[model samples]
Target chain A: MNLDLRLDTSGDFYARKFQPTKREDTLILNMGPQHPSTHGVLRIILEIDGEYILRAEPVLGYIHRMHEKMAEVMSYPQYLPNPARTDYLHGLAWNWAHVAAVERLMGLEVPERAEYIRVITCELNRITSHLLWWGAYLLDLGAFTPIMYAFDDRERIQDILQRITGSRLTYCYYRFGGVSNDIDDRFIEETRKQCSRMKPRFKMFKDLVTDNFILRKRVEEIGEIPADTCRKYGATGPVLRGSGVPYDVRRAEPYSVYDRFDFNIPSYDTCDAMGRYLVRMDEMQESIKIIEQALDTLPEGDYIMPKAPKKPKPPAGDVYFALEGARGKIGFHLVSDGDKSPYRLKLRAPGFSNLSLFSEVSEGVLIADAVSILGSLDLVIP
Target chain B: MSEENAKPEKAPDKEKEVKKKEEPQVPKYTGYDYDCFLAPQELLKAVTKLDHADFFLEDVSCVDMQEGFQVVYHFDRFSQPGRVVLRVMISRENPEIPSIYDIFPGAAWHERECFDFFGVRFTGHPNLIPLLLDPEHQGPPPLLKEETALKDLNQLYPDRVHTPVSPDSEEFVKEINNCSNQKSRNQS
Candidate 1:
């Protein structure tokens, strides 16, 4: 009965029945276009095994609204509003970068009062940007409560900035040679008061999420990008400083009234996602310091250069000007043919380069680790 | 530092006076050398030869010039402040340039974008494919040499009816081939 029931194969086919002679690689899976954790419409195609990722490729341009193309068709003055949409959080920083470039190209001088005001507004915007990032980054790491608390303080800055600039999210507040509006005594006093209030709240931020063990473990040592690799890829801003570069465009080039003010450029050499997080947090404090100094030395003059007319006439030549934006080095390379419209306009967006570094950094990282790595880079994905 | 100097305070209105006293008035800006303006043909080689010449190819799209296609590369130092521009002109028939991917890894994706928008090609690029356009798009590429694209479509397909190509098909095929070759090479 036993002999009749069983039969053994000569090649051990029965022993190897469940095993395949060859296994086809698994197909890559698309992770987002709808996922809230993606920050935006950023989609990542991951080739993974179980939970470990073998390859992670980010698919961008899902939101490429042809901003550059639109910039080409519009006049020089008309293109001012375009930068606001690129990074909605840091719209003013981009607006400042564009105007500063045009001012340099035309060889125009910004008034002392305008310069100080520009610095004050940009620094305040930078604080708001960092605060939003702090809340969003924490939210991405699965903490939900900080955003409302962060937004509560952020809205005050928004209200103050809006009172001066007239728009909340996409404010085009810079002119070719100066700012769109001047800050009155009441506005200056309100900003100064807000800074005093925000300092202790920032301390609360440090205590609340900075020391959370899960947050630290998720971001601290994962996805380490070395300083040299960072330099080669041309990473800038908080990402570059996070790797210990200490190269801030505000210090290096000194656009606007940045040279007149005194503030430390925060940098750390850890080169991890957590290192970036800490650098940005420290940077927010430094921004507040700069704002305080700018407010204390608020000058007396016209808000804009008197020579600049309603329509800008930048003489024929190329001028490349940059500013230290909240994200990184935001610059405008403007070529004017002595016309009302620019001959050629080149925008140097920091988010583009920062996003490119992700494919390299996330090569062997797990899929879960990749999202955390991207959040740490603090990009708006222009 | 200029911050310590009294020149800015002496006369903020005397901008022209300051420039005249600081340096000789040139035909253009004083910092750029007169000899640095390269012809369209020499742009690629000249830029590639500069010391520490990493290209922050921030954006690489083209405009439909009356003469032909003008491919512009917005060059800047990401960490440093210096910036430059390099423009290339290519005929509508075969628009191509030596890929700058070897110089800057970030440029490859930008080059694909140029291809997608303006139909220019980078000769030595590892991937010369469409970036933003849908392959199945029947209408012409949104930002191409409009007349040239019409001419191309007429020559390539005499009939008005044409089958659309899958946008990522070519890229997918090439990636698969490369992966297999890499696996075999690893085995060897």
Candidate 2:
């Protein structure tokens, strides 16, 4: 097998070395830092001999921002903006996780209308995140046009989301107990219109990318992480679903008014990157179904009811809260010593687990095939 | 529970306290077994129980207390709502803890950044390298020190001081200064 291995010496980089007595005759090569396959900034130092080979070690912390430590200093309200930075592609979803966490701690109830609005916006954000992944993953496979086509529709959703949230990336919209502000009638109408428009795009996505001969050849049986291993690694979101695990935070955990809405947690038994790609694409369609349901059943009430404290102080207890973020289960564990600032805050990011499987799946695959596998994983950020 | 334990034996009260603690331990969702939250304070011991585990070391920053530093360890379980947190208090003289990277292997960078910003040292970290800060800076002990606001951060970051000198003009001035110094030396 032909391998396009490029050595990056710009930084102090190292790979896992094996001794003759320990493990003999294994060739290793670096995969990314700038490799187009690694979705965002990630460098996986792989140890392989020829096409069929060995161990893979992932070097991380290139994108580490001490988000937890930073939360300790910032007030409960002040720390709202930073969660968006963790996974910027799905910034809205991260924001919702933090807000949901704080709301649960303070014992604040989100109104029916607010819950509907939250579900609608979150579902829209989910579809948009998935749409970008669809485009970017194809680009990783060396197909260029689909990215442009996917982005064109994704921007329409961005425009709608941006009006209420402000700023394209790193949205701080969902506040404690409710949203920062209510979406106007125009926002609601446009969202309903967007859902109708997205259904046909899903069919088109299936026709264009899913059924393509080249795409199938590249993804069919490549980069497979078995269901047992996926469970062992604590994989969530599409990564888990691709392994035929029917565990979704929305369905299983039931955050917000998700239990009220009807949707299926789609899974595939294939357990490859292609399975992951297909599952996410199908999830976007499911998200559209959810948004349509939410729009029709949106209740009539005040968006921001006054249950939340103006100067909130969470009691001295531990609370674990999570939401079905675009990437997966984005959760926060807040330990409050009855202070305005959280005593300790831990964020369980999906990309961290999803990306961790790279070393396992990328072993033995060719350089190009490795990129395809990484692309199929659809890691947003770690 | 500690309060009741301190008091003389009260069987009923002790049982109630144990029940209160166990309620939160139960999985928030039905039909799912989330028994991972019941582990003791040793963080690494809890992580090693599961195979192929991915430790998401979210953040490691210290809090400034009037007396000493309170080191917080936030543990998030991927299974369910049992996100466990463990904390250790360290003195102002020396703040240290055994690194979790041996178990997780991915926490090396998170621990280093924690050391960089807060000066909370991870004792067994393989590479305690500095990240996202100047290598040579005569600043306070750590960026998050109590004296930060009072001190001028720019003075510590002298590389921030610049005049944007033009290369062409700088060379021209160098030649002129060399000629003038030659003339003065010859005359002397």
Model 2 misplaced stretches (Cα beyond 4 Å): A1-28, A48-53, B1-188
Off by over 4 Å in 1: A1-23, B1-81, B84-89, B135-188
Residue A188, candidate 2: alpha-carbon lDDT? 85
Q: Give chain B TM-scores in order.
A: 0.53, 0.48
lDDT of 2 by residue, A1-382 (tens): 8886887534342442321124567655666767767756676776667765466656666666768778878898899899989987888888888877777665677888888888888778787788888888888887899988888888999999999888777888887778878888899899888888877877887888889999999998988988766654456788878888776878655678888888998999899888888789888888888888888888888787676665567644555676777777776766565568876676777777676667667666777788787777678654
- Please give the TM-score of chain B in predicted model 2: 0.48
As for candidate 1, its clashing pairs are A237-A328
Most lDDT-accurate candidate: 1
Error of 1 at A152 (Å): 1.9
- TM-scores for all candidates: the values are 0.78, 0.72
Model 2 chain B weakest 10-residue run by lDDT? B30-39
- Judged by DockQ cut-offs, the docking class of candidate 2 is incorrect
Q: What's the lDDT for all of these models?
A: 0.69, 0.66
